[model samples]
Target chain A: MGFDGDDTLWHNESIFSMTQERFRTILGGIDAAEVDRRLLEAERRNLGLFGYGIKGFVLSMIETAIEVTGGEVDARDIQTLIDCGKSMLAHPVELLDGVAETVEYLANSHRLVLITKGDLFDQESKIARSGLADLFDRIEIVSEKDPETYRRVLARHDIEPERFLMVGNSVRSDILPVLEIGGQAVHVPYHITWAHEHVEPPAEGYRRIEGMAELTGVIAAL
Target chain B: MGFDGDDTLWHNESIFSMTQERFRTILGGIDAAEVDRRLLEAERRNLGLFGYGIKGFVLSMIETAIEVTGGEVDARDIQTLIDCGKSMLAHPVELLDGVAETVEYLANSHRLVLITKGDLFDQESKIARSGLADLFDRIEIVSEKDPETYRRVLARHDIEPERFLMVGNSVRSDILPVLEIGGQAVHVPYHITWAHEHVEPPAEGYRRIEGMAELTGVIAAL
Candidate 1:
């Protein structure tokens, strides 16, 4: 079994944040919180239009900025918004409750691997900081945690797809990909998720948990 | 003017880290320092192969594990390294010194925007946390900050590249693209960099600063 570090185990976001805040600050004096609420609503409404990813967030922030600012904003604000988009690429990684114990218990039963994506050095440094580096049998820091990552990690451990189960927060990168390879999947939802990783209707054989606290219970059941 | 978030204002690495203490704990009666030195040597030597992303660092860790264990490490040990990688993806945003000041100062005279790429919501939240969000006029989250993002952002700004200077750490995304559009580029190196953002044969017109702390001096001179 495995997990995706960002979102699943900890908070992770893309880089749309900087611009969003800049917009709020520049167009302050109004109810920016309500504006933010509306923008978030617009984002959810336009999820289908933009899909998830950097491009979608960029356009949405611009749209939201323009909508809330009532076209009083300028190219400078849009430019700053774009800049914020780039700077806002991640969420702070705080481990979901019980991540450690679940992994510890699962370690005795199934092979546990941690698969994730993003800048390599940043990822590695975080692992060292987390102080839970001794849990897994294999760690794969892939460019993208797709089916390829899952298959390769499983293959390295000589784990069959049928025998393996992927426990993660993302249905897009983690669960879906593993399921594609005929492996089982367990999803543990984080408080927030990247819009891009949203799966409209989750596929079959996918097990979900509200938080990592319930992870061991589900995995033990599996 | 705009700033690059990763590797400019912040220290970001895509590689998972192996601490010296962990090495000593794993391999008893061995020269752990030498092990560290050898690992560094391998990383420096293989930096070319990995090229600064998750794929590269994962390969580095795998190679390091094989070398230190002499190909005899158990699944648990291998997983330990793997977990280190999973742990790596969860690092918090570590902003570089003077970056906040630079953004704040620039916000006064110039139109500031955030031009960056990566995940969407993750980026937005980090900007809000950074406390410098009020300074910029806009934030743009992008998927890939290639010429396209520059082109779109520039067109929106109604400012030619000659009039707009893009300040960032990545040669590929920040400097080269700005230069490609006839804009000025100020490169402020961060403590660490993502692998894929690395550029070879530094292009002309790209001014380099030792770090973000010196950014103000260089910008004032410009």
Candidate 2:
């Protein structure tokens, strides 16, 4: 069994959303939703160049701030974004409901691995703070969650795709890619989702649970 | 045989040095070397939080800028730093002397892996642009090139430590770690080095070559 970090095991996207709100407040005079749209656009444009993480997000926010403010942004405004980023980096890791109980229960019967994508240090820090380190047999903080990445990871561990199961929150990131590679997957919906991570659900061959509390039942059914 | 990407295969640290010079030029009133010292300090402090990459370096620059300027840094100054980051990320991949000829020479009769550490997208882009992608059988972009990372990479490929060989520029990153794990290593010195990657040479047990042109001969002797 593989577990996704970020929004699956803990609260992640909501923190980003809250940070975006702070950005919108700091850089007023632009439509709030428009600010989000532009920031997301900047983020997408920068993703290939910067990769994903708070540092990239902060850089994208700075880029968006300059774009929205017509290059007349204040130093303190940029400083505010930097501070926001640092604060988020320093934020406490709060585990989701039933995450500990579910992972603990599953670890007893299965070889559990945590396959999540993001900045290496950020993810490692969160995992260390999440206090679930002892439960996982391996931790793979990947750059992206795609079919190829999943295939390589499974191959590295000598696990067959047909026997592997992936659980996460994002359809684009965590679900479809695994299913595409002939691996089983379970999608547990989170309260908030990044627009970039949104995708139309696939037609078949995956499980969906409303929350992590239902995970054990899903596993038993599997 | 495994190769290190950044300084070993291509021109990398010089670009960072050029950027640091530009950073000094933009933020006047401080000694140039003093600027470098502070930037290095910020980088070391941020290493665990931000990880090693261009993104982390940019964040360190911003943090150092604010520190040096006493929170009086100009918005334009911050923008210039951001532009510096973008320019670095978009820089072309220029292979070092004899790198192509050496790797090409070695690839014919050996299993070649490129093991590099940094921002995933940036490293991938450099590798793709390096025009040497077809030569490598596997590309491992790790978060850090430590003993555990080397061990994992070797194990994932089912390569034993005695049979594995690593070649790179930094003693801290490439040589000692491989040697510690019973793997052969060749250290080819680069003209520039990052402060964080500098370390006192180990007592023994690794080959040191002057350039990539000599790599083929070293491998032949082995």
Candidate 3:
């Protein structure tokens, strides 16, 4: 069994959303929607260069601030953005409801792997703080969670795709890729999704559960 | 056999060196040594929060700039630093002399693993661009290459420390940690070394080679 770190196990997207709100207030005169759109564009452009995590996001925010303000943005505002990033990095990892119980229950009967994507250091620190690191048989912090990456990971652990199962919040990252590689996936939607993570729901290939509390039942049914 | 990526296989520290010089010029009136000092201090302070990589380095540079300029630095100057970071990310991977040949020669007879520490995306992209990826049997990009990390990696791959041999440039990261775990290491010094990677050379346990050109001979003698 594989688990995704951000949003799936703990409150991740909410931190980003809250930071985005702070970003809007920092650039007070600009329309919030316009700021968001530009920021998202900068993020998309920088994804290949910076990859995932707060560091990259903050860089993008700074870039967007400069772009939107025609290089007239305050240096103190840039410092504020940097501070926001530091706080985000220091943000506490809050496990979602029933996550600990579900993960603990699964650990006794199955090998649990925490496969996440983001800044390597950030993810490793979050796992340490999550207080559930010991429950995992293995942890893989990858750059991107695509089919090729999943294939490589499964092969390294000597597991076939047919026996692999992935649980995460993003359909684009977790579900579609796993299903493409002939693995099973369970989608547990988070209240807030990043624009890049928004994807049309698959018609029928994977299972959908309301929350982690229902995970054991789904696993048993499988 | 494990190999270090930065400086060991390709040019890494030199890129950082060039960027630091650029940073000195950008900060203008500040003493070059002072700029370097403050930047290194920021890097050390931010290491826990930001980890290692160009992104974090750029962030530290920005922070240092703000400190030296007393929040009076131009926003355009900040943009220039960001641009420097982007260019560093896009910098082409230049394999050191005899590296490709040496790595390929060893790959024929041994399982070559690339164990590097840095941002996941940055390191992965470097590996891809290095053109030596295919020669490696396994590639481990970690956040920190410490004794415990080395132990876990060796255990995961079913390798005992005595049977493992690591080759790298940094005594701090690649040699000392491996030796602490009873593993063999060969130090191949690079022309340029980062301040954070500096440490007193270990007296006797590991062999020191002049360059990658001498690696094959050292391995055979061992």
- Which numbered prediction scores highest in lDDT against the true structure? 3
For DockQ, candidate 1 versus 2, the one ahead is 2
Tens-digit lDDT track of model 2 for A13-77: 88998999999999778899999889999999988888888999999998899888877787667
lDDT of 2 by residue, B1-222 (tens): 999999999999999999999999988888888889999999998787777788889888988988888877876678788889999999999999999999998899999999998877788789989999999999988878889999989998899999999999999999999998999999999999898899988877998999999999998998
Off by over 4 Å in 3: none
For model 1, the stretches where C-alpha displacement exceeds 4 angstroms are A13-23, A27-92, B1-222
Best DockQ among the predictions, by candidate number: 3
TM-score-based ranking, best first?
Answer: 3, 2, 1
How well does candidate 2 match the true structure in TM-score terms?
Answer: 0.91
User: TM-scores of the models, in the given order?
Assistant: 0.41, 0.91, 0.99
* Ten-residue region with minimum lDDT total, candidate 2 chain B: B70-79
| TM-score of predicted chain B, candidate 1 | 0.67
Chain A TM-score values for every predicted structure, listed in order: 0.68, 0.98, 0.99
Model 1, residue A20: what's the lDDT?
Answer: 60
